[model samples]
Target: MDKEEVLNEKYDEKLDRQDVEGQLELNEEDDSPIEEVRVTVPNTDDPLMPCNTFRMWFLGLLFTAIISFVNQFFYLRQTQISIGYSVVALISLPIGHLMARILPTRQFSLFGTSFSLNPGPFSIKEHVLIGTMTACNTGTAYAVDIVILQKLFYNDEKPFIAGLLLVLTTQITGFALAGALRKFLIRPAHMIWPSTLVTASLFRSLHHSVEREDDVGRMTRMKYFLIVTFGSFVWYWFPGFMFPTLGMIAWICWINPNNLILAQLTGTNGLGIGAIALDWSAASYYVSPLVTPWFAQVNILIGFILVTYIMVPWAYYTDLWGSKKYPILSAGLYKDDGTAYNKSLILTDGIMDPQKYIDYGPMRMDSFFALTYGVGFAGLTATVVHVVLYNGREMLDRWKSARTQNEDIHSRLMRVYPEVPNWWYLSLFILSLGLSFVTCVVWGYMPWWAVLLAMGIAIFFVLPVGVVQAVTNQQPGLNIVTEYVIGYMLPGHAITNVTFKTYGYIVNVQALTFTADLKLGHYMKIPPRIMFMAQVVSTFIAGVINLSTATWLINTRPNICTKEGYPFTCRSTKTFYSASIIWGAVAPDRVFGNKDGALYSPVQWGFLVGALLPIPFWIASKKFPHITWLKYVHWPVLLAATSNMPPALPYFYTNGLFLGFVFMFLLRRYRYSWWSRYNYLTSAAMDSGVAICGLIIFFAIQSWEGEFPYWWGNPEDQDYDHCMLANANYYGEIH
Candidate 1:
């Protein structure tokens, strides 16, 4: 048959399948909740394409290396960019089709089942498997942060084997937990992880062809994606390298160069209240404008304004903790004498010297920095309280109904393959736990009791965090809270403190991340066994590569955390190092305890305040049920707004929230058809384009010792963004 006839036949088959499955029809005017919007056509189990094919593994490894190296490199940079999954999804499509066309398709028997080196045609399942592998590897392993801390800050180099084992164990343990929770997270139709829907759309757009008769808009999503992708790729170069000032427009700082407090409130390097950022890289560092919902973005802005604009400025002007004695915004720990804390003086052989620390007096932080930590404590408590208040009943109902409820279309499609067994997950969990425990005790110098306690913390937080991420697309990180608990318990042991925090915080994050991928796999109808193997194997490979890359960078680069390094200043590792000092070397009791006069004693009350903040909102929602908007006031999300104040520039939130409002709220409401057709496709395109350009710039230009010529566009000044507060006293102190 001709192409048109074949396309018509496939369309007819899809309609017949939808009718047979009793699929729910969706319309633009449908008032049904977003969670209830089902696919127009149910997935069919046909062709039975080979999932664990040679081509799949080959591409998985290739991308695993690229993503791991790129992510590790970016993790150390000032901008702290992560390679998004869309980049992988976009790149993998053409490559998968090419492989299908080129590779041998000879059938072979494996354990009495037939398989092929190449699938009959490039299948969606194969595409998903490759994406899954990419997802598992696209971000730097959490253990690398700890390793960087040990090597760069503490001057202690962990053996390569030990570091690799630690990375593998922590990552796999989380995967095991996700595997155990798959039934609850992956099977439920209502647990529509919003990001996965975007991935699904992208996958279908790439793999499936639409009939011209049924196409609503003259422009296809793929065409729009490619056009936008190429445009973004070209546009990024202007702000990314040549004109650094485009990243952060400190207009107020430039206009009023003499006023310290004014500069502190508005400058990007200071409070970042009135800064305008033109760079997408700076704005989307903390939260992706494309993924977060409008309501969440609004709530985040609310908290951000309250803290940075009002509270921080008021406290600083009032000289709370004598804030005027130091720079208005700095992550650096200070001393009672109003000077930078000399870390070298307090360290002897990479361990804290108690006498030296005592002689050095108490460590002090910038007022804004302390406020960020306070908000973090509040965010942690608010997460648990908010989830329980808003989603607790729904979760319980899901658990009860999961046993007997009729399968949704996606679930029905997934029923073609056997579910992964309980023992498989349990065995992996046990093995991972043992490996982690051994690594902590032997290599990390963590106590056995501490290791168990950290694992217990992960177990307790995983479910709530998972629920929040599955529903809201945001995670209230456990880093600060975990550090507080562990620090208080194991005072003066830096290694133990960091190790505990790593296990407690990263384990939950990894589990949630893995569970999100599982939901993606479920949405795409990939077999559970194949998905699990892909993640496990790819994570291992990526972990090794990440560790190697980190090692190479640290060894080759000198003065990593100094001003001399410019973009390679190791800002992330320095932040992690400071955290270790606060929670490990100094101890929370010393900073926030009821001492005669502790600098940040008042901030400790944030935990209590955070726990109670969500109660009023929950009660208000119940009392005035007609005011539907009240239910969406998420305190955890609000608190998260201030969490990035230290590492991320203030303009990040301002610009990102603006885009979120534009796309998620305005466009979605006023231009529903356009929003539905192209919103996520636009997001995917931008992310892919930016990531590809970043890679090219790093490898081709930056790596070759080439430099953009010094000119007006590329200035030689350090603060090219013009974000520095012009107060002589503060500037001198920092310099």
Candidate 2:
């Protein structure tokens, strides 16, 4: 029998069962296993739908340039932002439909095959390809930071070609790694990549217009999406611009304005405890409330409470690392004398002056800042431990099955498309490796062995980190660990330290991001080869645009790294530069080793502590299998949650968790029908709205020296939310 005949017979049998008289129907309360409802992948045999069309390429290049420029421009600002993928995915659909209506469908022959510039109709595949292109340019290139560091801090000007090559090499190397892991990561049905489900549902809602009678209670997804998108866009103006204080509401600080301890505990710009941030930008800064599961949110919440409310307060009150002398929450490193550490005083010819350093005294970190590193150390170890304990066997099984197994439903459907050859990925990897090696050795002034070590570190960690991100939509990046390793290996070479850290840490991040995109392609059933080509091409485009944008910003902006710059104060770059001094120039041994014997010296043991932390949870889950909650206790999530103090606002956790519980738990459990239809669409709409409005506000007003007229609504102090705790005397200095 034909496959179609078999499917039809199964469908007819299901209908016949429904038609049976006097049959008892299973209700929601029934304990029996529900019959699996299989959805046939749509348009599997439709070849006329345009995917790799000229229109796609044209629109892709246009959007990639816009998004890349916007993203790179924002990356240098105090509040680093990126264009959301949903913005691109949502915008592309209408543009694609418009092109389909106008473009001619003239066929042409290519390599003995018939093709067309406009293949009969617009396709979801083409929409996804466009999204893929936009997604590549959504984040600032990692190498851009390295180039900025060299120029701004070290005063070393790199040739444009050298910078371009460095960016291309790092970005492409990650893509190659992602491609190599396609069989293990992308070809699995269970690797749901929860985030991609939102995009997939949005695609179906847009392209598949034929609604059934079963969808009677629900509004059209597009209509609902538009309503939410517009509402969010309008709502954001008050919090995002005119009344910026709406983002952070510290009621405790408002009530007790003069109490130093209370202010430190409750202020948004202070320790950020007992605060309620209303803005989506502030609430969603750390994690997306819509996509992250309630269980994960709960775990993160518990960790935040323990760290911020308990650990941080205890250390601060006790004056650990002389916490009472400095602000409780700061990323800045200070001198032991409790004054701000000036880099210029200690630097002689772009390298640390040993005599100047000895005279200046050792650097001291804020109590909370030191604690973040300790927590980060614990998070890193816990990630490895948790993955091995919970997922090792599953990963091993998947690798073994990749050789012969064709069990996954998505994989079986995807077999129709030609696979991207392994040699293609290998060739890209080899070229990227050679180029990166040469750049680092020659321009970066690093030994050949160090470059090789960096690449090796990336390769070793990518798989484990990829597995963690694939299963849980979070990745514990190798940034801290990479710096620690390289610092010890090649001390006093700040440029080489950052260069190594970029390759070692960012390569893994880029690879996981690419793999996620590849999985999105898999879900949408785009051909593998086309996805590969689109990713590589778009990445190259992003490299050029990002470098150009960064160069322009640096050249045009004066006082780029100073206090006078305010919003353009290079906050992120300063943090990066600080890490180089602490880890590379001064050396970790001086801070955490026997020389200091400070409060943070004990933090080095967190690795050993973290390794043992997950064992109890794993054992409990196995021993008490019926206690279901025990299994959900993910140590990595718990440990990682504690490390969000410095960079992220505290209310992000408190607010996002509240929203997640309300949506994922309350709405999902009680209003199943509504939740099923609108949850993901609502998320997509909100993200798209906020992102679109942000770009308009920046480009139209802020970038052109335009500002909202100062009033109570728009404060001149930049503390319109009144979240600043006026207790500068309590902590000697306010960052």
Best by lDDT: 1
Regions of candidate 2 where Cα sits further than 4 Å from its true position: 1-48, 78-80, 110-113, 402-406, 556-559, 563-568, 596-599, 726-735
Clashes per model (N, Cα, C within 3 A): 0, 1
Cα lDDT of model 1 overall? 0.76
Q: Write the per-residue lDDT of candidate 1 for residues 70-138, one digit (tens) a residue.
A: 888878876566777778888787887778667776888989998777654566678878888988877
lDDT of 2 by residue, 253-363 (tens): 888666777778788867677778778877777767777767777778877887888988899889887877777777777777567888778777677776777777777
Clashing pairs in 2: 245-721
Q: lDDT of all predictions, in order shown?
A: 0.76, 0.75
Worst 10 residues of 1 by lDDT: 28-37
